[model samples]
Target: MSKYLPLSERLARETGDQWRPTLAEIEAVLGFPLPKAAQQAAWWGGASDKPHHRAWLDHGWRARDLDRAAGTVTFHRDPTAGQPPPPAEAPPVIEAHRGVGGMALIGAGVAVIAGVGLLAARLMKGRKA
Candidate 1:
């Protein structure tokens, strides 16, 4: 089954294309990652039969409602009353630093300790001699 339904018969009449956005497109527009379960629900049809298609439609409605509430973009729904509020904006992205600063500090500390130990050993040997 297709991940998205064809534009509603009414909408198709108004809009030129039967174009419907996929689950991935919706997530992209929202600029966030959805939970695995929600993603599954949204694309369930991408792998299976008619029920998955139906599930995608049902969950897609909820997701679209959330996107609208977050003010990411405007969307219209048929009959309109069942719409939910927009979802919250996506959280900021995290970046990991790959610099060796931490490792370098540890290496410097180890070297200092080793030098102190060697100096102490040499002084003790000199005293014994």
Candidate 2:
């Protein structure tokens, strides 16, 4: 899609708070014309859950000083939120039962080895007798 989501994200990261690049500057970052929705100012707002907004919001940016008549928009980064933390998920739980299973496998191997040794010793005794 021509949402320019990736391009918007790059611009937000590349520009500092004082830096306000014009539409042309943004297009240079994009390397192409603004996307269908990107061309409109309303699409630049962060309040909406529009897919394009996430491209900037995820990177700590929100639209500001947008001059539609002049074809310019400035992106301001969130100082407090320099980076958004990853979404919350269940923490990995480690259990003490793991080592018990491994020990069981080791014990089985030792038993087999002992049984084989006993059988070999019995065979040797029978052969000698």
Candidate 3:
């Protein structure tokens, strides 16, 4: 059996999906396209046995460790540096309609109050004249 048999079988059985690459199958599933150097590092045994990928293991290079695992290869960062942090999440967007509706309601209220006050003032002034 190929070294990737277990990973291929697991991916097929769990996700009902098949990926043909002999190496880096897990990375493909995770949507992280590994660089050529990373792939080679993983192929040479620098990652973990798990399906997940990490840039380091035991605070050291794990490229060689990953090479020994069956199924798909994993990539690891060199011992000198840790993996970069995950990308920042975008803030949720607020729709404009709600804000516009609030502003419209306030404007309408002010207009009605001003109209009523003007009518009351005119009536009082006409009575006095």
Candidate 4:
């Protein structure tokens, strides 16, 4: 079967928006019966994982609103390939800085408290009162 078809491109151009093509029509353009994969719904899922989707996908057409019971698939020109996510509004960044002087002051304060605690402990241990 022909891997690609001119009809797909022509249809995308002429239809300009939505084109519902029957399976028979697709096969006719392809010049052969579609492979078994075509019968699978995923074949028209607009995902690029399968080779069968390439025929229409290459022409920038994507499947939409697939109706399995009705045996119909709507193809739409998806040049955007789905639009990109809207730009995120990031939270403003906050910078915190502790200078060497600030750290040293904290350390000194801890040491003074420890010294006082030790002195008090020693005095209480030595005295009856």
Question: Scored by CA lDDT, what does every candidate get?
Answer: 0.44, 0.71, 0.49, 0.70
Candidate numbers, best lDDT first, in rank order: 2, 4, 3, 1
In model 1, the Cα lDDT at residue 56 comes to 31
Candidate order by TM-score, highest to lowest? 4, 2, 3, 1
lDDT of 1 by residue, 26-127 (tens): 456445553455443343223323442343334332123323223332233333223344799987655464547787899999999999999999999999
Question: lDDT by residue for model 2 over 1-129, one digit each (tens)?
Answer: 536666656755674664466778777876777666766777787454566566566667777777877788787776533344578998776786648878999999999999999999999999999
Candidate 4 lDDT tens digits, 7-65? 55556566567888787776677677766766666767745645556656667777777
Give each model's clash number.
4, 0, 12, 0
lDDT of 1 at 29: 41
lDDT of 1 at 71: 31
Candidate topping lDDT = 2
Candidate 3 TM-score over all chains jointly: 0.27
Error of 3 at 5 (Å): 44
Model 2 stretches with alpha carbons more than 4 Å out: 1-9, 36-39, 46-48, 79-129
Q: In model 3, what is the error at residue 100, expressed in angstroms?
A: 0.6
Task: Point out the worst 10-residue segment of candidate 1 by lDDT.
Answer: 60-69
- Candidate 1 global TM-score: 0.26
